[model samples]
Target: MRSVVGGVLSVVVVVAVVACSSPREPLPGLTASATVTTAQTPTPSPTIDYSDAELGIVFEDDQSLTGDEAEVYHWVATLETEYWRTLTTNTVSPKLSSIASPEIHVRMQQMADKNASIEGGHIGGVFRVQVRDVVVEGESARAVACLDYAGATFSDPNGSYTPEEAGFGGISRQELTLARVADKTWIVLTRTAAGEC
Candidate 1:
């Protein structure tokens, strides 16, 4: 899956997510901030068209990446992509359990609860994800990733959420702890903010 197509990082995947993650207060819950927020009932904005974003997820192709490191990068990218779909679909995706911990799964559910009352707008952009480092020790693994959300906008009833606005920001760095379950698949144990990268 790490095969470079055409160039070092030109293989952009425009994933058409059918059902995805949660988005209510902001991306902090599922994003790099990684802190679960209490559900808030925001004033409902009247909008007919539901907002959706065209996902342009491009991962850095490094031939040196193999084994555990490659697996970590792949799963983390999948998790991010699925989480962003929450903004477009506005429903907490149930698929997270397969890739994330139980706590992270609940956090996403909280986000969807918030999305219930917000207005929608189609936010267009690409979410750039790059793995910074990976460490493996027995059945435990940790991966650090830098996400560029400069091109993305959160779901705002008022229309658009500026990068500096309430819901989210530009670029963020996250450190995730993963555990190898009985199935031999890596499940994300924790995802915490690691400041700007």
Candidate 2:
């Protein structure tokens, strides 16, 4: 009797193994050798090109700017964009030479170094400047602008920080002093924060 039970159990185990290992028939109208494909990634859009005249450097009462004053305004307005690009590319831009003085360039380089040392890594952010007023006196020029930090964002490995959280946000008025260089270009000599706009 014990041998007979053992023989039955062996047959049951063999049947279960065969059932699990067997292949199933394909569905009607479907082939077993059909290929599968994955979705492709979408391409990124090209960056928009903004002309120098449309950099949002507004003057009071639509006042017409002189040739030198206009040049200074355009250069100062574009500095914010250049600074942002530097942060993303992790390389100092030669364009800075035309916009900033030697002392100001040194300060910008220091800031870039600090950005590189940020915990985790640094991501790009938006920086916009509006020229409220530009005063050109002989070879010297002074500009008052409002720097908007609302759209600025910084990210780390752990998380992200906004300009406000980083204590560098809101609308603050800045005064920039520029001097006409020998190349018939204006360079920012000093940039200081004035009171709120």
Candidate 3:
């Protein structure tokens, strides 16, 4: 369903995901990057400094994000929001408006609908999601997320209560990898998800 609340357009993102059209070439094997390095000293986890500027977007405490982890987390959150918006509206092509492919967007939307159907569904609401437990190594990071996803009775695509019936609430795991694109920013080269609850 589609509707407008205040001015924000809200859509119920499905709980499913699509496989990548091009599966990444697996490293020679699962252990390709896990090879033990004698000279490698483990980097200590950054002290939780929730006051970091980058954390302002979603996190307010050091418990979930820190350092480069914060920046990458925020970046992913921004991308996810934009991607969901485009996917729900179906006004813009996913390939042009998002870092993901149109196929993936289509698949994810379907999956979300299925998941919501099983969970009683929703019509519409506001959403706030953030990455949690980010572990950064060099330019790569992995983190789980806590999604504060909900829908308000605003824009209903089919003029039905579908969005409100399926008020948002789900927790999914996400993996992210980043490469430096500039002195202060990095580009998310890959994001993959497996299984959701």
Candidate 4:
């Protein structure tokens, strides 16, 4: 009788194990399903469009500007703004390189390096930038601007004057040659002091 009971128990255990391991099928009128979802990438925001009037820039025919001409104008304005901001803050902003061409970027980097060397720190005064003219031809263009250095100063950390303070002079004219790269972005190819400031 004990052997018979053991055999019955073994049979019950085998049946339970088989049922648990077997694949399940949905009953009629019932269904099993799984859902998969994918994430979408967000689109970048458009760049802000700035006008000559907004930037305090004066030009001969500011009223009428072709699309390309306007783009070049904005590029130059943005570049100058970033340059002065860097000077005043005494910090190199990545935004400067974005608007500058390869050569201009290198020059700006050098300036930033120099600014980093000020032992006691310095204060940069505000200056005015007047856009004289901008001429665009295809992917290349030239922009002339007058940078007024009046009231600008770089004093030493000890509140004493330094020779570098004399470096800031009067208004100077700057000429910039720009090229529209393959990415359709304008970059300053070269920058030079055209005349006295």
Winning candidate number (TM-score)? 1
Model 3: worst 10 consecutive residues (lDDT sum): 9-18
Query: What do the candidate models score in CA lDDT, each in turn?
Result: 0.67, 0.69, 0.49, 0.68
lDDT of 2 by residue, 111-181 (tens): 77887777676654555566758888889988887766676667778888887777676788888898888
Candidate 1 residue-wise lDDT, 40-88, digit = tens: 9985553222122445565553425556766666677667776776644
Q: After superposition, how far is residue 127 of candidate 1 from its true place, in Å?
A: 1.5
Please give the ranking of all candidate structures by TM-score, highest first, separated by commas.
Answer: 1, 2, 4, 3
Q: What lDDT is reached at residue 161 by model 3?
A: 48
The TM-score of predicted model 1 comes to: 0.64
**After best superposition, candidate 3 residue 114: deviation in angstroms?**
14
TM-score of each: 0.64, 0.62, 0.44, 0.60
Candidate 2's TM-score reads 0.62
Instruction: Using TM-score as the measure, name the better of candidate 1 and candidate 2.
Output: 1
**Candidate with the greatest lDDT versus the true structure:** 2
- Answer with 3 or 4, whichever has the higher TM-score: 4
What lDDT score is found at residue 15 in candidate 1? 29
Score residue 129 of candidate 1 by CA lDDT: 70
Candidate 2 segments exceeding 4 Å error: 1-64
